[model samples]
Structure formats: C-alpha cells, structure tokens
Target: MTSTPHHQPILDSPYVLDLFAGPGGLDVAAHVLDVPSLGIEWDRSACLTRYAAGLDTLHADVSAIRREAFESLPPEINVLAGGPPCQTYSVAGSGVGRKALDEVKGYIERLMAGDSDEKIDKELQKLSDPRTALVLEPLRYAIQATRSPNRGHRPYDVIVLEQVPAVQALWAHYALVLKNIGLPDGTKYQVKVGVLDTETYGVPQTRSRAVLIARRVGLGEPFLPEPTHQAYEAKGWNRGNGEAAALTHQPSLDEEITPEPVTRRGKSGGPLPWVSMRMALPGRRKPFLVRSNYGSSGHPGRRGVRTDQQPAATVTGRISRFVVFEHLDENVVYEGPRFSMNEAGMLQSFPPAYPWSGTAQAQQVGNAVPPLFGAHLLSAALGLPVPDPEALREPWVPATEEERAKLRSQGCGAADDCTARCPRPEDQAPPRSVSQKKKLSAG
Candidate 1:
C-alpha cells in the first residue's frame, strides 16, 4: 500500500505569534482553551509556558523576530498576539524612569523604521520570529508619545479611522506614525483604540484598555468587535437598537458603560459586558470600600493605596513575588510588609497546579502573566465559551500549613487556592519539563 500525505484540519485552531510575550499569560490563556500558539519571549517565565503546555517555545525579544523563519511555517498562523512590555506606559513602575510611555513611544518609533537597523534588531529579538506588531495604548499617550522631531506637527489618520470613543485621542500618535511614514489614511490595518472595561465584558476588574485591532489584510477600519457583555455606558449615548435586554441591564458601572447597542444606519455588535470585580475574580466575601488604583495612582505624587479587602490591582511580570493576605488578627499580616511569591501570583490568577521552574534565587513566579485574565481575553477573541465562574473554583496547591491557613482564613472555597497563588507544587517549574518521555517541537 502506498503511504498518503496527511491533510490538515480546516477547523484546526489558528496559530498565534505571541510578541513581547513576557511570561506568556496571553499564550497560557489561549492554550488553556486549546488555541494553537507559538510564543517569543525574552523572559524565562514565558518560556516555561511552552514547557508546561507541551508546545514549542523560543527565547527572544519580540521586535527582533526573524521574518525568514515564517517562510517555512504553515500558512494558518492567523493571529499575531501580544501586549508588548507596557513598562513605558505602565502605572505601577511609573517612576523617573521614562515615565508616561516614553519608552513605548521610542519602541514604536523604532518599529516604524525611524531607528537604526541594529536597534530594531535588538528590540525585535523580543519576539522569537518576525511579524507585524499590534500595540495597545491610551489616546493621550498614543498622540503625545509618537511626536518626533520629524512630525509635520499635525494629528493624522483621523479621516478614515473610526475613533474608538474615550481614547480616540490616544490614537493621535499611532495614527500619526503611520501617516508620517507615508502610509495612507486608508486601511493601514484595522485599528480600534478605545477605553474598554473587563467588567462590561463579564470579567470582574474595572480594567479599561486602549485596545487597537490591526489586520495585515488591509481591511479598512476593523469593525469594532461586537461586545457580548454590557455593564456601563457613556453619559449620553442611547441604547443601541435591537440590543438584548439581558445584556443591557447589567449592574456594572451603572450608567458609566455604553448602553445596549443601538444601530444608526450602520453597526453590528454592542460593547462587551463589564464583569464586575465581584464577578470576574470575585472573592467569597465582599471587597473593601475602594474603587481602583488600576491606573497610574502609584506614582510618587499620586496618592493611591491597596487594602487587603480588595482584589489586587493588575499583576505584572515582575511583582509576582509579593504575597498579599488579610490577617485574622485583622490586617496584622500586612504589617510585616512582604508576601510569599505563591500568594501574590494566585490573586493575579495563575492555576493552582501549574508547575514553575527556576531557582529560588531566580524570580520564577514574578515573571508571569495572570492566566485567568489572559484566558478571558482569548475567550472574547476566539469566540470560545466563557469560563464558568463557579467552575473556576479549583483548590490551590499549598506549600506549607501556614500558607494553607492563610487561604482558609481568607475564605477560600477550594483546596487549590493556596497552590494557585504559587503554581509551584514542588520548589518551582523550569523552562524545560522534567518528563523526559515527551518533547516539544515546532511545525
């Protein structure tokens, strides 16, 4: 009998290129639901994501990706995903070090070819392979940051681009860069920059992002993704015609989010539901009386403080080492002013049993992406079923009895709550899996 070539699955999940992958939070989320992903990360925690998932991984910077690598790959890599190191615009590390998105601005400028080939090669290394990058940014930062000495000194791309409300201003800089490089005002790539909340999309935190959608296909103004969940509305925008009542009456930001989708002569979907802090990563008990320090509140001149009763602010690649908890002696535990690495990562949403590898001397858990948050974003993009809130109640694996007590006292509903915080069942997970029987290879 003659051997035949194997046919590929048409419905096979699209391959993804994770850029500036950090600790692969985005890849982990997509992988949890079975989305095929290839990640490029300069950091070790992100490399561990591939090892944990039985997938291929490359250690490199995103901007440094080698385009020649793609010539040999399959054509199905439908998506290029990433949240490039937002340190330049991040609210947490906003110190004297290139505050207010300066570094990201520089990165983007380099991305547009204004920088030296060597510099671009260095930054591009953040990606294991080469592909166009999609950036997420706020309107103000978008415009102000992209300003260069060569700018003709005018906001561009406002013509064909549909301004995603709230952060339309943020698009000023991004739009300008494309225009300055002589790219036309037409479909440079589907760009949508707006202030979106996770709660409105059915996640808990009141996180708002200046999301931008880019498609290499040159489709003019990528349609604003139809929102599946509804929570808040702008002060005056009316309900979209034909929006479902179930989606409109959300208890979220009350009237702060966009109302039900009402169509003008044109429109397809409504805003996503805002999953309140209570809904997404909800606690068994109510959070303390506080809004959110989610933005740039941690800046020195800015006054912001976190309390034990509240879900933590967004967890980043570094700070995963600090543990957070409430003291039965009330808030006494916090008085010590430190947390176990395991405790901090859990609050940010890593799974309870996922193993991490690195020396204690190395920042293992600190270099991670909150898997839960990453998963939710993937669900929205792939149109996969959302994670059932109740089903997410996995018991965390704990390191010690004291850690167990810490979770129990905090009203943990599952045994794994402790482990979810640390992810290391034994010591830590490494970039390479211990199970030698298996191997991860690239297509």
Candidate 2:
C-alpha cells in the first residue's frame, strides 16, 4: 500500500526513509525534528497504529519491494533508517540460532556469486528459514541507492540501523562491508557500531540495543551520539572524570536517590536524573509494587519490583502480566491493576495520546525504539543539532484531564505510600506449543 502523508509534509526538510517502521517510533522523532519521512511497514497492527498517528507509510515487505519502490523520493536521499524484525536474533527468542546465522551468511555469499533470484529463492525455501536473511534487506537497499551515483543518482547521505544487542556482530560485519564500497564520488562510507543503553539516552527504560551509523564519504568520521543522561549504574564502572571523557552524572555509591515530586521538572545538580517510573507514570505514587500474572517464575532479582526511583526494566509485549502489588504486614495481594498503555508509551518516550490502535498495543509499544533516543541517533546520522529532551514533552496526558483520568483508571492507586515490591520474579513468556511454531518475523 503506497499511502501518502495524512498531514502536509515539509518538502524541503531532509527526507528519512524508514524500513520495518513498526509503529513509527523513529518517524515520531523525525517529525519532532521536522524531518519529513515515510515508513515502510508490513505488519497490519503496526501500520494501523502508524496511520492513526498520522504518519506517512507504505505497507509492504521490505525484502520484496526493492529500491525501485522508493523512486518517488528525492534523488538525493538524506537519511536511511530501519529496525529489522528481530525474532530469530533476540536472546529471548528460540529459533534457528547460530545455525540460521550461518545459513544467512551462506545465502549472501551465493548472491555475490551471481546466483539468480529464482535459484536463491529455491535454496532459501529448502533451508526453511527466511527472517535471518531479512536483516540484510536494509543493506541491499543501501547498496542499490549508492551503486550508480555516476549515472545521475545520489547515494543516501546517512544510514542508521538498530537491532537487539545479540545482533551486534552482524552489524559490525556490515559496517566493514559498507566501509569498503566506494560511492559514485569515489568516497566510501564511514561506519561505526556499538551497544547503546536506552537509559543513557533518557528513554526511561534500561534497554540495550545494537546501533549502527554510517555517513557517506567526505562527511567526516562516523561517531555514535554521546550519552545525554546519567546511568544509574555509573558509579560501579565509571570512576574518574578524565579531561577527554564527556561529562556524565556519577552519583557516589553511598549517595541515596529519594523520590522527588513527579511534577518536578528539569535537572538539579547533574545530568537530568535518569528518567524513572515516577516521571513516566506520575499517577503511581511511592512504594510502588508490581505483581506478575498467574504462572511467573524467576530467582529473586531486581526485575519485577519497579519503583518510581529507578528506570524500568526492559518492557516486553507480555507487560500485562505484571501488575501493581499491595503489601500489608503478612499478606501480599494483587488487585488486577496493571501498567496502562499510556505508561508504557511514556517509558518508550512516545508522544502522549499517541493513537495506538489494534489488539497488539502492548506489543507495538514494546517493539518500538524510544523516540527520545531515536532522535539522538537521527541527529548523529544527519550531523544535526541535538534536541533538548525537556523541550520534547508528550502532547497529552497528565496535561490533559480526560487522558489523565484514563491513566488513573489503569493504575493500582495514587497514594504516596503505595509502592511496588522490589525484585519480583521476572515475567518470562510461556513456552510455545507445537501449534505455535511458525516462520520467524520482526516488528
């Protein structure tokens, strides 16, 4: 589906082409920065959410649609960004594992051997695994975009990619390959890849992801965005403040972080306190406790109990299972209240009142890149000015009375004394039944 923008797009702004756009997380950031963009997505649920949010989208399989599909875009593409579906590569997923990885590498090698698409398709069919190879689709587009600059085409100026940290090795390999290809101008791309902690970028969640950035030749050295927020665990590993080190908030190990007013905004003494649940879900008061659904199991660890004082653990699609816990002397109970979709969206830095549609609201939120962090990556890719996080506020909720009421309804309680337990059992997905087995896919 080739859909046009629901809103007028700025024709002069740098254009961002997003692949596997999910629910338009990166596009949200692009919009905030006034960068016109179009997302290519295939998932029906995610596309509905994107459309509801008024994002321009083209619904199609990235692998099947090829570069010819993007000919309508400006000749000189400014930015290329994508987060390929990561089912087979996620540590949480059980799939073809390392074997699938090797098969993908073999497939790429054969393609380089001048193997025809029909032959490759048949061979991939025999392997019975496709998602592992899907990760290379972005690379395919990049190569095609820059292949004929001499023939009146302009290569994309910047490229950005992200995936689970487990896929870091794959990205590093791509970085090397991208560095070797000369564009029409005889300059190669400068590439860099590393694991980025979302908390360090003000995402309000401690999700670590593999990030890759590449700038076309002549744009100076490629570099990752510097961390804009202080990490809670900084005291353990970062000890000294050398001259060359970028400034970061490093609390003393003995220092204590008490809960501040949820309304309190702006930085106090150091980099803005790593965003916490309190700031993201202001309705939930102190001593906040979380409980998992029916059959959750895990060793005692700081996984389940999310306090307003700390950033949340990585949010997964199974978030509904985790709820607020009420403790009273010897009795512990959960009264069926769970974190709302709005709260989850805030944790992911999505705009307030984001029109999240479809039954997979939680899944869409879980899969998106945090918009605040995404803005940082985009800025780095385009060598643009970094956006002030404070200036980027959610458009609704807490601010909107009607939305605030909805958020309150989903919370356990608003009492200051109501807090979740610390270190509750981790909520792992139940094992899939034989009937649940299907081809792998990514968000």
Candidate 3:
C-alpha cells in the first residue's frame, strides 16, 4: 500500500486529509468544490476504486498514518475529515460497540489524560472486535494535530467526522474534549455534534449519520449544515398519530407515478422537496417498485416496499438482495430486475459513471457518505455557500457510443475499469431528455 498521484494535482491550500476514506465519497465532494484531498484507506478494493476515480489516496491503515507518518503530511493540509468504520456501531450489524460504549469513553478519558499509546493499545486488543478501537483514531489524530504546531506541523483548522447514528454519544463526548484542548495559539475549538438525515441534505436515500464538526475558536463558530430538503415521510404511515394505512396502489406500468405534494420549508424558506428514487434515476420506461430484502417492525418475513415516488430506504452492503419490479396490479406477481451497480450508485448520489472497481462495489457504495450530502456538509463546515438542490439533482448524461467504443478499445469493459482517461460527467453534453439519458447504461 503506497501513495499514487491522481490525474489532478493536489491543491496548495485548504486541502483535506481523509481517514478511513472508503471509495472516495468525501473526496468526490472535495473535487467538486475544487478542494484537493488525500484519502488514507487500507482496503485494497476501495483504494483501487479511488485511483480509478482520480482521487489521491494513500492505501494504508489510519492508525499507521497517525503513528508513523503524521509529521510527513503536507503543511497545506488544514482539514481533517473521516467516517470511521461503523460496522460495530451500526444497528444493522453486531452491537458490540454499543455495548462497549462506556469502555470506549474510558479510553477517550485515558487518552485525554496523556496515557501512552502502548497502554491504550494493550487495552484495545481486549475488545471483542479490534475495529471497535478504530473509532477513537480520529480523536487521536485531532489531539495530535492540536499538539503538533510546535513541531512545525500546522494544526488542522477544520475537523469533520461522521459515523452511524449510534455514535452520536461518542461525538458528544468528543465535543467536550475538543473544546477543552486549546490550540497552541490559545484558541480552543468550537464544536457541534448531532444526527443528520441524508435526505434532509438532498441525498436521494434516507440515511442518518452522526456528525461532528470542529473549528479553531478564532475561526467562525461551528454549526451543523442546515437542511436544504424536506425530511422524508413515508406515505400511508403516520407515526405522529399512530395511524396506519395501506400504501397507495401501484399505477400501471405505462402510467406515470405523480410525485407527492410537498410544501415544507426551512428557516430560509427555500428547502426543496425530498428527492425521490424516480427523480434520482430518471428515464425508466416502466414504473417500478423496490422490495427490500429485509423486513421491518420485527417482521422477519415481511419485505419492505418503497415506491419509485419515495426516497430509497437506507442502502446497505446487501443491496444486491433488493429486487425491483414493474408496478403491476396486485393480482399479478413476478420476478423483477435488481438495481444495477450504476443504478445503486446513483441512488446513493454518485455520478452515473463513477468508476467503482473491484468486488463488493455495492458494499462500497452502501458504506460511502453520499457525495451530494458530503458537498453540503463540507460547504457548511468551510463556511461556503450551500450548493443548490436543483443543481445537485440535474441529471447526468450516460457515456456516448463513441466513448464506450473508445473504452472498449482500451480493453475496458466499463467506465469503472478505466483510470486517468475516464470520462467525467462535466465533460459530456447534457441529455436532450430523460429518456435520451438512458440510451447508454453504465451497466
């Protein structure tokens, strides 16, 4: 695992160093904002995807970088961002981290008390899963950054971290620690931590993540990004009044499903409607219904259904198990298509032709922070203007026949197989219509 130069040069200022950077999710957002970033990821598959996406990546463990190479980071890198491994903390996975919360807090206290790395490492090994200890890596990096100014290493001015909603308590503890640890310049950090809904930020999927944003007190106060889209409310179910009703019946395959009316507004009075699956992946000839493999409300056999009219349910590594079918009358039942890798990526707000590589790409896409959401988060964290929701939802043109042929000639089967020469969404002409956009599938 080593560093490789990307097609684009790393910028000289406001650079980001991303830890546990799986498949360049935040990196994509940084690139869109013209902020250069270097991601440190240990997974070979994810690193391969990062290289394919033209994202600068150091293919190594975050712990290794923090310990053996912290001082080697470029002085221009002033932003620290990461989404640590969340499997242990995710509700969908084993609850080891949740059960071990107090122990983790103890480690945080020990670290703040100046415990030696060796002593912490010895205790961390005692966890049921060693990855549980990785969650503290970001805190370790933050603490190191605060103390490094005397050694010629510039302390990170902006720190952003995210994980499963289960980590909100951990982030709360982080806020307290960061505020007390004054920078060498005698300025403490302004910290904010909370849970954010991805759909509220215009991501097409309904996912919740715990986020922490910190900045030096001399900089502007830290605050969470405001919601730019209305939060999603699943049709036919009312949690507010404890009322339940059957979902509206499916329309015929040829009939279009009208979008639900939305009049919600934010403080800016400009928040848009929650983005739907149909809006996110337009150009389908037939209306489709997605049947989730997993059940809801303790019904192990009851698969959940989401109409094209709504935002997709939280995408998981097992998204391949989800089946998509043509919307038909209730009397009929048949096998339907599963979402293609590209379709899944788009549902997660990746560009139509984003170069996903290696195996477990669905997992990679599922684990990633939606780049669209990342853009808004980063914009707020950096005190930049938020990106327009309409602009973010603008459809991307699929690869042209000529582009596909050129890729084929280069011995590439798909855009993801190409590297530096991969065609970018901005490089292509906009499609004349949504139907025309589907002319060339990334599949």
Candidate 4:
C-alpha cells in the first residue's frame, strides 16, 4: 500500500464498519484519515481488489452477517457506513427501465413493517428484483446494532449511507423511520438526507448520489458535507464577457442540461482548478467517441464522449463500452482508444500504486465511491478537518511493462479468487393477488 501523507484521526468514534463495501472506497478513505475501518463485501472480485489493497474485509454475504458477530472487533465500531448495490435504483439500470418502481415501493413497505427474517427472505424469493430491497439492509443492520441487549448495546454514534439519486426519497423515508424508532439508549437518532454531486466534492466525475447520515442522541441533526471544489460554473462568471466561468475546463454541451460550474471559493475566488481528464490522464488530450455497448439501438442509454477539460459522466460498470473519441483540434471526432483500467481507477481516486486484482476491472472501479469524496464525507460526519480539494489530486501515469508483470504476479483475476460472482438482478413478476398500488399505500 502507498503511504498516506496527511491523515489525522479525530473522530469521537473513529472506528468505521462498512457494509456492501465494494472495492473499499469508504474504507480507504477512513483508513487514510487514520480511522480504524473494516469492510464487508460478498463479491469475490470486489474482495480480491480489497485484499490486494490490504484493506480489512470480511468476504461474506452482508445478509448473512449478524451484529453480534461484531463483538470481537476492537474500538467498538461507532460508525456504520454503506452503499448497497445500486443496480436496481439507478436511472440507467434495467430495473428502472422495466418500470419496477411500484414493486420497489412494496418492498420498502415490507421492510418498514419489520418483517421476520424468514418472511423477508421468502418474499425476496418471490420478487422479480430482490436487489431493490437490498437498500434496506443498512437500516436493518443499524436497528440490529442498536437494539437493547442483555448486555448493554454499543449503539453506533454515526451512520452514513449513499445510493443513486433515484433512491433519494427512499432514504428520506428511512430517515423518518429512524427518527420514530429510538435507539437502545431511548434516544432518537438525528438524521439528514440529500443528493450531492460528486464533482462538488472534487471527484473528477459528474455523478450524483443520494446521501443519508444519522447521528446519535447528543450530536443533534447531522448535515451533509459541503462541497470543497467546483467545476463547470463559477458564481460570478460573466457568460456575456469572454471571461471563463470558474473551473470551466470543458465546453458545455447545452445550457439547459449542463451542470452549473462551481469553484473552491464560492462566488469570490478559489485557487485550485477542477481536476480535469487532461489533469488526470496526462498526454491523452484528444477528443473521441465512447462507443456504446448498445450500439445503434440505444435501449438503455447512449455512451457519451467526454472532453479532457471536464469531469467525466458517471462511470458505469460496463466501462469497456466507453472508447475514447479521437479527434483533431475541436471539430474532428474519431473513435477507437478505450480507457485502460488504471485510468478509470485514477478518476475514482484510487492510489496509483493500488494492486488491482479483478476480472471485471471497469465494473469494480465504476461501482466504487471515490475515496476523495468519501474522505470529505467522513470528515463531515466525524467533525474532523476536511482536506483541500487541490491536495487530493495525485499524478496518474500508465503502468510500465515491469509493473504489468508484477500485477500479474499478484493473482490471475478475482474470478479465480472469488467463491461466488454476483449475478444480475432478476426481474420478478409482481404479485398477482395483492394490488401493487394498494400495498405501497398501506405504508
């Protein structure tokens, strides 16, 4: 593992336990900031990457793990963090495309009813898309952790959860549930939920996620972390004048759909430039078309081309579909070169020296919470000092032939190491007898 330069642990309860911790994004951030952390992930490929990175992880299904099992851990895990698989909740996901929201709402209601584990499991078997309910796992774990025990409960001091923007309302509803149900200490958990753009947190990507945070009795209501970086639009940028907006590294496609630019220093001024693709990829500045796996049919969505000057669109699991758009000057666009695994990793803020061992390299990278953004959230949750966005950028360079050989020496691929591969979420036919709208309304 590469050495972390400026980490100072300062949380009331610094130990963090991450659920659905794919590729250790939150774990990486917590650890680098000197917080003791543990990750639980079921995917073998994800576990392999976690292992190669030297992160502490439990290679088992999150559903199978019980809170009592955490008794053996040290420092009394006070923070609970998770980003359950978002495949079912993403706008680009097949689940949403299939119009599964009504069924999803029913699942949430069932979960809220506090159905028995056996019943929930059986219901899951019946659902066409069980992954939609996986979002409840974090809340389930939290409730289990905070229940009064024969022995005094070690209630989590803070809880942080994130998902795609489509799940924002679900998390908001969860916040209300958490508020209604008091912890073992008979204190209501203060909760906050919202949507945040990754670029605002200095991630070199234009991804938006739904965030939910809860703090124990005394801490009061928690707040979402404020953005430390801005891109696309600066507060006072005069579009009429030639003067560019703050951090306008990339050209906007259109005014209607474009994300407003931001800067480190609000409307006034900030020193650092947004970390553009050019800054991260170095030397690969030409424009290019990112071919879609969907081809011309364009069912889910069309693959997009990104310029070196801007943060990239959300990186998807199928990143191989995104080929670079080669071009001459600004007008001519060509297609062909695809992003290497390392390039994707850098954009996600993984350290340059990270040992990557996984079959679906792009999938693992795409699924990760960017470590820089994670750190920003962690700092906010713990009331610690947030790092400067400028300080977060590390130089990314292509692997040399020798480095490639060493990576090979690490392991074949996560496929070989992982005991089980996560399957695509199935679409279960909705219940015939019970009315879907009625069930959702019952909650």
Candidate 5:
C-alpha cells in the first residue's frame, strides 16, 4: 500500500469493481495507476487475497450479486472491469457439458455486429437476449444484468475485460449489449480487442493477454497505443539494414531475424520495438523455472520471467516457480537459475511494495494484472496523453549472482527440496525466502 498526498493509506485510485476478481489483477493495475478500485471475488480465499493488497473487496459469488447492487454505484464510473473466471470457457477446463456452448456457437461466431448501429447498444442487446448468444460468451449475461448508466445505475464511461482470444465471441456479445442500451450520455463507443505482450509494456515476462478498450464519444475515437521500445532484429543487423543493431538489444536470429509482428505502441501499421529480456528482467538470464507440480505445471513465478530473448508468456494462477527450467533427469544436481516470487510479481506488473497475502502461489499470481496491458487499453480509450514510457514500465533487474548463490546454499534447487514440492496453490513456499527484493517497477 502507498501513502497519499496527506500520507493516508492509498488503497486504489482508478475506481473499478473487479467482479470475479481473482486475486485482483485488474484492480491492481487500476490502483497502481492511482485509480481507486473495488474488487469482488466469489472464492473466499481469493477475496482475502485482495484485502491483503489493501483493496476494498466483496467476497461473494458474482452470480449472487444482484445487478441492481452494481448499478447502485456512482454513476460516473471511469471504468467497469473484470476478468471473470475464464476457466470454464477456456479449452483447458471446459468439460463435456460445456457443450452448452456449442448450442450458442452462432452468436459467438458472429464477429461483426454489422456496423449498422453504434457498438455499445448492440453489445447490451446481445447480452440481454435469452437465446444464449455467445457474443459475450458466458459473461455477457452478467454484464447486462447491471443497470445501464442511463437508468441511474452504475453507468460506466468505459468497460474493460481481459481474457484469452478464444473469448472473441464474447467480445461480440458485449458490443451487442452496448448497442441494445444505446450510448450512455450520448457518448458512443467503439470496442477493440488485441493480443498484448507484457514485455512491450516493459515487464520482463512475455505474457500475452487479450485486451479490450472501449472509448466513449466525448473521449475521442478509439485508437491503438504506440510502442515505446524496439527489440533487436538480427536479420536487419546482419543484412546491413541501417541501425538494426541500434533498433533493439535482443539477439536476432542469425543477425537477420525479423521481430515479432507488433504495432508501434500496440498499433495497427508498424511493429514496435520489443523490450529485451535482460532489459526486462535484468538479471534472470540463467534462473531455473521452479514449480510445485500443481498449477501451470509449476512455473515458479508470476508472469514467469522470460529468457532466451523470447516474449514472456501470460502469468497465471496455480503456477509454481519450482517447476520452470528444471532438468528432467531424476538424479541430476539441481543448480541453475530460478526466479523468486518477487521476480514473478515484477513481471506481472505489481508495485514492489504491493503486499500479496495467502500462499505463495495464490498471493503473487493472484494479485496482478499486467500493468502494461492495463495501460495499453486505458491509453487507447482516453486518447492517452504523452507518457514517460520509463515511468510506466519500471524495469526489473534480477538479483545478483551472489544473492542467488546464497539461495542455492540454502535448500533451494536440491533434489531433496524438490521432493516435498506442494501441489496445492496455498501450500507452496517462497523461492528460497519470501522476502521480495525490489519495489514497484512497472506502470
């Protein structure tokens, strides 16, 4: 928690409600930006996890929270956002009964609301319809139940949802719901969904998340953000392309490799320079990927630290640092690079001082929503003013070799330590010790 101008505990600033707010990542981003947020999580332990972050949260099943209650919030909400539990819809978790989704596949399949009307109302109607429209997938119905801004309910100026790309059909559902409700304050809105890399936003991890930015009429037309850094493109450097070496520090493929396709600043036309791994995580070049063999197959950190110059993958719950980059041989000595929970939090966009409670796996991964991705969408919706890119991405440096040596001296990386690895999210230990080594580093 941070102090305000008067030194009071600063809980949140952007003012959002994290419905199904698993460990409050969405809320964390809004709060880091000084946006006040109110998060709700159905899982009792999950709610306590948000409380640990100093956030005000309601621990209730989202389904049970009447839409009328959410509508009662202040009408001028800056943003209404959440990453509803996506596991049920995710291919990884959907069971055979998820066939309920197949019945409504057409609604999900309909990508375009036809551009005939404004995207907002269409989104609303799509959600409110009983036909099980997949436009918003499973979550749309919940969103529509809330009163519209016009109805004196908790009217939102913007809405943001984070999830995997498989939920694109859900995006269409939201558009239709907004259309059904018509634009609030006569402020029309446009919705856009894109794949965002945390590294681009300055986090060392290469986590990719689906981002949706909805801009209200007065704010200005929706726009994609521009990239602030460049990853080294090896092909250009080797081909004698002017300034290829200067473009990025990431080692290129054969000195002539092309970089990941990206819009400059998350743009549509040009690719933005990628943030480098060493530049991103600073000292994590050789750490072992540790885990407890439970969540995420046991990657030991949030936004698991990226190396080999690749983009960091999305940080997820049920991940354990004890699992990453481990040798397969049962008898091999376990000396190698590994990430501390603090390192994982840095990659996930949490402030260094951000207190994560609960078990190690639950606390770190649960509280973060990649700040880079959060800023990416907000900037687009508000026609973002110029930002100090450095300020937004407080870069993270790994612990020095000496620090790692000490962790190794302890029980870490030993085959014996690996034997007792806990599988439950709440039963894990800190990478070596739980003390985080840094303060907040990303926007």
Candidate 6:
C-alpha cells in the first residue's frame, strides 16, 4: 500500500463497492485502512449520514442498479461488500423470512441450476415480505461480477457480506455457489461463511452476525479473522439453554469487578477482559444502568439491564427507547440522560464525530457494522495485516472543518433540506477525556 500526505492509501485493488450500505460502517473501516469505497444505499437518512461523513455514495436501491450499470462502472472496483437489510430475518422482528426460508433455499438452488434473474425475481415477488428477497442481492451481484461480461473480464478480487445470524444457512449456500463458480480465466473463489461474535472483535456490544468472505482462487485461502478480544460474559449471571438464571448482584462500577491484566490472554489467545461500556464511554463520574426497552426471559415487564462495567447489549433501532438510570434499586429508579448520537456511534466503533445526518440517527448508528470489526474483516479478506485493537480503541478525532467543507463542496451534504438534515459541529459530542470530571447524567 502506498499513501501520500494528502491522499488515502492506495492498494493494488483499492476500489470497493458496497451494496445496501447503511450509514457507511464498512466504508468507514475502508477509509481507515486506506481503501477507497463507494456505497449504494436507498435509505435517504443513511445516505445523508454517509455524505456528512465524506463517504462516496450512490443514493439508489441495489436492485435498481442492474448488471449493465455495474458493468459500466470503472473496472477498478475489485471488492464487493454489503450487509443487506435483515428486518425480515431478524428474530427481533417479524418471522416472515424465517417462515420463507425453504422458499429462499429453493430459489438459491434454482440460481445454482442456471435459472435466470428474471425468473428468480418473479418468484421472489410471491413472498409475503419483499425484503426477504433482498438477502440474495449480494449473491446476484457476485454472480454478475464474475460470470457476466464486464470491462475487467475478471471476477471481483474479494467479496464480503454480512447479516443477522439467521442468514447463516443462506450464506452457506452462497459459499457453495461461489466455490463452484469461476472467472473466464478459470480461477475460482475460496469462500468462508460463519457467524461471528462482535464482542470478540473488540466491539463494545454483544451482537452476533453471519458473515461471508470470498477471495480469488490465487489469493491466499479465504478464512475468517481470529478474535482480538475476549467475548463478553455476564459476571454473575448464568445463561443456559437460552435462559438467563438469577443474577448474583454486584456493584455497577469498574472497581467492583476484579481487575484482570489487560495483557492477559483469553482462551482463544486474544486479549483479556472484554471491552465494557465504561471503557467505551469514559469520563463518567459514576456508574449507571441501561434498561432496555424490550423484555427478557419472555417477561414483558422484566427489562434487561446492563451496568457500565458490562459490554452493552445488542444495539438496535429502538436504542432511544432504552432508559438510562443513574440509580436503580429494585423498582425505584432515577432516570439519567440517554446515550448521545456520538456515544452510540462510539459503541458501534464509529469515529466520535462521524457526522450523522438526517432523521432516525439512532437507527443509522445501530444498523452499522462496527468499523473496528469491519477493519478486521476487510484486512483478512484483502490479505493485509490485522490492525492493532488498542490503536482502534483510542478516541477518534472529528473531521476537520476544512474536510467537512470539502465534502459539502463535492455534493456530500444533504440537498434540499440542508439546514434540517446536515449535522452541525455543535450537534456532535466529542469523546470525553479521562481527565475530564463529569457526572454520568451530563450530556
């Protein structure tokens, strides 16, 4: 890789095109690693955020951009990445996709059996939730890039896809298809598919996602990246058979937990002591509790609670609904300030001042692939050295005013509703320094 003082790092195959890109999470990781990328996202809010963050974006649906358009694009696009919308497949949402799993598998089988896109799309229209078919868009793109006539006449050097763990089986099908397909040069792809725990990648949240990675045959065999941090396990809670047992109460403070040396190795030989909410959001004078909006153990009223010392529960679009409590003793509660956009973004491993624009900002943050985790995935896919987790953990500075201005000049800011959608400097909260003394409730 080569980089200049004023330019991004240029790799042998630097260009990436991310389909169904939500708020440029993977794009942020690509930028950090010096790989230039463009994201295609239909959500206006997500596109606005991407523009605010100075990311290359095309505000269009993945399906709308057909194979011809893809083939017409610059041939330097060697990497294809995406995390398709997972609402239908998510256990937290409607079980429409789960119910239609067999239908989807049949479609995949047809695609592998040389079925045409038009036929598959026609069959997909019969599904109850159309979004269920979006999961296969990545596979469609992969097939087109490799088999269809294009400028390069070569397959994408690397391909990465991610979605809810419910889509793991679908990814397995994708792995099979990709492995069997070859480029005009007879070079096939090496594929790996599995579910990864975000916490193991040093994210300050316990979210699991199914990921698929593919590389050209000649490139080193494709494999998932190894863990860089220990997975989060509740200190005093026992979880078995998907049931949470009674909690052995402990103080919700960093000092309350036994201090394990950071240098210590985990069972996976990764760093010891998983990152906690306290570590991710510093400068808090007191520990606090986050009460999730959703229920736990099939009890509607029993809201899930995680102390600052624990890694946060999986963040979702409903994050704003979660209540933060300065004090919670049984039923009694003292409500505290909720996490700011910056804090939420930080937990997702985005830069502190990643200019979040437009409405449903929390949803944008929640839907993102944690940049740190994305970095690891991209590194592994591109045959690059894994980045230092500690370096990624450090506070990230906000984009400079000049940089933001440049983005705006390049048509990155929200159009038509700039005043309402574009993020202001004051709107962003910088990472709190350790030396700064502030209450947990302080904004």
Models ranked on TM-score:
6, 3, 2, 4, 5, 1
Candidate 3, residue 87: how far the Cα is off, in Å? 2.5
Which candidate gets the maximum TM-score versus the true structure? 6
The global C-alpha lDDT for each of the candidates, from Candidate 1 onward, is 0.39, 0.63, 0.69, 0.62, 0.45, 0.69
Among all windows of 10 consecutive residues in model 4, the one with the lowest summed lDDT is 294-303
C-alpha lDDT (0 to 100) for residue 382 of candidate 2: 70
Record all residue pairs in model 3 with backbone atoms less than 3 Å apart, i.e. clashing: none
User: Candidate 6: TM-score?
Assistant: 0.78
Instruction: Indicate the residue-level lDDT of 403 in model 1.
Output: 46
Clashing residue pairs in candidate 6 (N, C-alpha, C atoms within 3 angstroms): none
- Candidate 6 Cα errors over 4 Å, as ranges: 1-11, 90-96, 147-150, 181-187, 237-270, 295-303, 327-333, 390-443
Judge candidate 2 against the unseen true structure and give its global Cα lDDT, from 0 to 1.
0.63
Clashes of each: 63, 8, 0, 10, 78, 0
Q: Which stretches of candidate 4 lie over 4 Å from their true place?
A: 1-10, 67-75, 90-115, 148-151, 183-185, 231-267, 270-273, 283-303, 327-336, 389-443
What is the Å distance of residue 269 in model 3 from its true position? 3.9
Writing each residue's lDDT as its tens digit, candidate 5 over 114-174 gives 2322343355354322222322322332234233554444335566777655555555555
Measured with C-alpha atoms, the lDDT of residue 336 in candidate 2 is 35
lDDT digits (tens) for residues 1-443 of candidate 4: 01112334335557888998987788778865778888877666776677667666776657666533444444377788989876665556444623555565565555556656577677776655566667777866666665535325667788898877777777777777668855434556788888777776677766777888788767754767766666444223222221122224334333122223434465555534456665555535443333333321121221233345556656767666666665443454555478777777777776665556667778888888888888877877777677554333443233454543343233222323332223212322323334666778886
Q: What's the distance in Å from true for residue 204, model 4?
A: 1.2
